[model samples]
Target: MSLHPRRTGWRFQWVTILWLTAVWVLLWGDVSWGNVVNGALLGVLVTTGLRMTPVDFHGRVHPAALAVLLGRFALDLVRASFEVSLVALRPRYTPRGAVICVQLRSHSDLYLTLTAELVSLVPGSIIVEAHRLTGRLYVHVLDVETSGGIEKARQNVLDQEARVLRALGSDAELAEAGLSRSRRAREVAAR
Candidate 1:
């Protein structure tokens, strides 16, 4: 009857706890002291029971890359909200929705999970399913009327992965994700 979880080289699951707490806070729509305390407690309890086999991560965090990803996410969120609103409100307009399957460049389970969650968090798209073995994401996207639109959506996912890799992926992981350091620098410069 061990009280603590078996060691996984990591002392604490702060990331899981914090992410769960944030979700709890957002779902409750309140950030009061009481709510926060309850959320944190719930986060701890939930994370304790839902332990996963930790995978090796050789990633390094880059503050600039994180900032850029956040900025881009914010802008995309706003734009997508407007687009969805328009599609819903307009009478004559029909959004071309499709289930797009995108093969991820990063085969790591962590990267795939992060990319899927982040993409689904934004409006106008949702990850309907994910194939772990194939590293493919089946996302239902709005306004995907043409083949070009589908390709654009796929590219968007790839770009999102690239941005994430730039922020927190190791050198090997970045290369696996098909984003070279020079390409990353070029992307930043283009922005």
Candidate 2:
């Protein structure tokens, strides 16, 4: 009943072999027939000993969205650095700090991890904790000017999540659905 060949095992074995060969070439930089043979043997041995893990391939992501996210992150880094420098130079002028919670709409663990990493990389904010159950992120911010500070931080997280969703090729309907779910959850929690 199956049209595909039973080649999964062979494919994995070959991957292991290729990986070992590449590693050998990098480590020694000597391209000889002996080295190639040895590397191939080593690869087969190692790959066989190691367990194979399945790869998760979702829909194709847009390269342009990724570029945009990278650019925005770089710009934010520069701007945050300047702000942090000013804060450090004048400690007295630094506003009071507070922690803000951001609820993520995306269900992907990778996206959540990336967003947390990006937020933590900024100058004045740090990710305190991520709730595994709800995908809510708690971030501690260095400067807090007014009551709106928390809301501002929440907005920044949402904006970053939107960019990631776009990069992952999610349609407008999915995006709206995620936003609605997140909003409803927040409201329920508040009540």
Candidate 3:
């Protein structure tokens, strides 16, 4: 009987255990009862021994809004990729990078962090720091002018936060972010 030991991750995650078992079985080249059971035991030991705090998610998902958020993220990714490439290809052009601080409208730290992560995924900008107490994020832009200057970059981060709120925010959460659910979204979710 052999088991694949897994590292500690988030708290009491069932998916982690299942994934560890699957990886163990895959590595062994044959699925057997010993491997499965042993793998689960190892997963349990690791997860229980070292636990991380779980994210607090208090919102019902709006499917349409979620789709919109994902679609926009993809588009932004592609657009940013090209922009970064163009800047790199220009030999004579000197890019000015700047760190811009943005205050998030969302009251929840979850959305604030999520917004930061999403913006970082796009090219030309990365999250430098997130201040949860003040609900602010400091992002470093690769090229300020390429990203349409400081104020525009700041607006982009705020827009990203709005997208996050629209996707997974409750009514109260939306209001707290200074955003209102679209009439269409409200109608669709009502059903």
Candidate 4:
């Protein structure tokens, strides 16, 4: 099934309305007629604010995939927290800080942003820059135990990308293209 859809202004309006109402209910915890009107107005203002900001391509995504991706991210965050904490507590540790380049397969800006944000939130790594033209991410890591440290970090990013691609229902070509590009970039950098 084709997930992509042509979104209209009305759709955006409805989305904004629904989102605002939900937020209001959550915040106030009591829904009354007054709250309903206020929430709707707030939604409109929020939508207007959003409209003023320019965003890149907004693509339709598979719901199942998105759910899976979110779940995986949650799990990864928990695991990363533990790992980072352990690394931090070790007083006699020699941290090998290195900037690793990660190649992303999916061209979606949302996916890229999500990946970057998620990785950066983790303790040991931070995404310093993302090259739009190359779809490559430069990540600064807190620890590196040799030259392979960069490669390991790159692999972690690639793994996250793979999960995102799967969630988006991307084909093998797209996945392979991203991995190939990343590998090639790393090879060139190494040489």
lDDT of 4 by residue, 1-191 (tens): 22222333566568758988888977998888888889988887776655343334334465776787789788877876877777778899877688878878766666688778878886678999988677888999877753246777788888777666555534453445443224465587579
lDDT of 3: 0.86
Angstrom error at residue 132, model 4: 2.8
Model 3 lowest lDDT segment of ten: 1-10
TM-score of each: 0.75, 0.63, 0.76, 0.68
Residue-level lDDT of model 1, residues 1-191, one tens digit each, is 23345454334567667877888889999889888888889977876777656655679788888898899999989888977887789898877789989999988888889899989998889999999899999999977753248889899988888888888888788766657655567698578
Backbone clashes in model 4, listed as residue pairs: 96-144
Please say which candidate is ahead in TM-score: 3 or 4.
3
Best lDDT among the predictions, by candidate number: 3
Off by over 4 Å in 4: 1-8, 20-37, 49-64, 146-148, 169-191
- Could you give the C-alpha RMSD of every candidate to the true structure, in order shown? 4.8, 8.3, 7.1, 7.4
Predicted candidate 2 versus true structure: per-residue lDDT over 1-191, tens digit per residue? 12232334576557667988988877788998888888888887766665544332243577877788889999989988987777778846747899889888865666677789988998888999998678899989887653247788788887887766666634553445354224465587579
Report how far residue 141 has shifted in candidate 4, in Å.
Answer: 1.4
RMSD of 3: 7.1
Candidate 2 residue runs with Cα over 4 Å from true position? 1-57, 146-148, 176-191
lDDT of each: 0.81, 0.72, 0.86, 0.70
Residues 110-140, candidate 3, lDDT per residue (tens digit)?
8988898999999999999999999999999
Q: How far is candidate 1 from the true structure (C-alpha RMSD, Å)?
A: 4.8
